[model samples]
Target: MASKQIQCEICFKEYAVGYCKTCGHIGDACVDIHNTGKVFQTHSVIMHEAVNVHEDDRENPKVIIRDASEERCKQHATERAIFLCTRHDTMICGRCLHSEHLSCGKEVVDLLREVGSIDCEKVNTMKSLLMEVKNEILLLKDDAENSKENFKTNADNCAQECIELGIKIKQRVDELTNVLIDEITKKHNENESTYSRITRTYNEKITWCENEERKIDQFVHNNMAGYLYLLSRKFDKGVSDVRSNLREIKHKHTFKRFEFKENRVILKCVFEDLEDVCEHQDEVTGSDDGSVNDVFEPTTEIQKTRRELTALSHKAKEYLDKSIKERLTVEAELKRTKADLNRVEKEIIDN
Candidate 1:
């Protein structure tokens, strides 16, 4: 029976097993020296020299790989070759052509040479616009911070006013309460003294009437009607005087009520002509013309400015996030380009 042989994918050398006996690959072929042609030989020679870069250090295989890739990218980077190679998407330099792409037949273009001749007015305009946008962002951030600080200051002032006003109100309330108590005490004392004097006079008059009655009892038959008439008249006069004093005391009681006003808090009482004075200020600026307007709330322009500031603040935050992301992307690209440059330098030194 005859044995069937399998071929390797890269090197078409045939073998009679599951793997290539020469290269130890999972195919029956010599993969090292197969269908690479002359171009592959030149690339391999360049890669071998690049792989031995900084042989003193075993780490950083990327450094050697990058060196090889960059060298190859620069070498084969012509207009046609750049299209063929998926790594470097630019045209190859003159130095790269002779150094690495010695056997390659691919056509090349000089992108750098072309760019040097092209007009860049539009690019410059875009760069200027980008600068202006960046400056606007910075100014917006500064203004936002300033506005926040001003708001904090206003809030602090309001809080301070509330505290001071509260203290003044409590003080006024206490002072008025003390005065009311004093008036009530004075009026009560006067009423009490008047009632005590009237009661004593009543007792004295009754005693006098009793004494006269005793004397009249001794002469009962002769003087009874005359003494009774005199006693009645004197007692009626005393009762009238007592009623007049009681009315005076009632008037005084009404006077005590004058200290308190109807439907008003004691703290709000207007004894010494006190008033509350509060002030507020608003300032608005336009972004285009930098026009400023200072007005009270409820005005249409003021409301619009507030809304615009709020919207602008939100937009600023969103723009900041996007700018940060873009900056990071640009920085990453710059770092990759720098690394590519370093690799090319290292490869040039190696070659």
Candidate 2:
């Protein structure tokens, strides 16, 4: 029985302890550490007991040697996978070498060997690329934010300018309306004064004519022949004087009526001319002083700034579109790089 005691898998020395520190196997009997033949049988029983014990100690949650190692193979539940089948791209335990990978034609390689051969520089390069893309995206984000603020500021400024222009136009219209009203009122007052003067002169002429007719009537009623004869000559002269005055008054009245009609035509022409003047205020040259021009035309500086802002806005839109596309591309590359990095990390841990 003593000679038949369990032996250590690594040193091949007989061991009575359940665990062998030299070979790192927990069992009453140990198989060759590097041999795949009997390793499954020996490790299966030991790992099964260990898993049960670990489950029972869930409250403590202590880390076990089995927990730190690779997972056991599905076919050989206690044997950890140690080989990677390149042909099938799968992991297998030692027992799978003869059973599943016997006809694989040398495609199987040690998992540790493959993992060790990985180039860390490639991973570092990928990390650098991811960082660079991240930085570029950050810059794009900042630019977008700045552009948004600038757009808002420009829009607000334009809105304010439009409001000011509207106010100025309203003021100009009000001033024009007042000026037109003043001109119309002045013409109306002149016409009224002329009418009053003409009416008073016509009334005085009529009263003088009536008094002369009464004097003629009284002279004709007298019975004395010599007195009547003398009165007749005076009356004839008075009649001739009255006729001349009447003719003069009639000619003056006719001239005054023509003048009043001309005044009305002139007032109509003024209104029609004013319509054209207001319509083309910008083209009209009034009051050689440049005040009218200033009211019609925007300042050179303001127009120049408006053009510049329009061009800048267009450029900003183009840049924003380019930035968005670049950001999307960078994000896609970042996601792919992250996936590759995770795969590398997982491979390292598994190895």
Work out the TM-score per prediction: 0.36, 0.36
Q: For residues 1-351, could you state the per-residue lDDT of candidate 1 as single tens digits?
A: 111233433455543233222222222233333335444343222111123334543442222222121222433332122222124334454555566544554444444433344368978999999999999999988988987898789789889988898798889789978988898888878767767766776576677668766765755667668776666678667667756756765554332223545556543545322432334456554445665444447433233344587799999999999999999999999999999999999999999
Q: After aligning candidate 2 to the native by TM-score, how far in Å is the CA of 278 from where it should be?
A: 20
How high is the CA lDDT of each candidate model?
0.55, 0.61
Alpha-carbon runs more than 4 Å astray in model 2? 1-120, 209-351
lDDT tens digits, residue span 212-241, model 2: 666557767764567567766777676677
Count of backbone clashes for each model? 3, 0
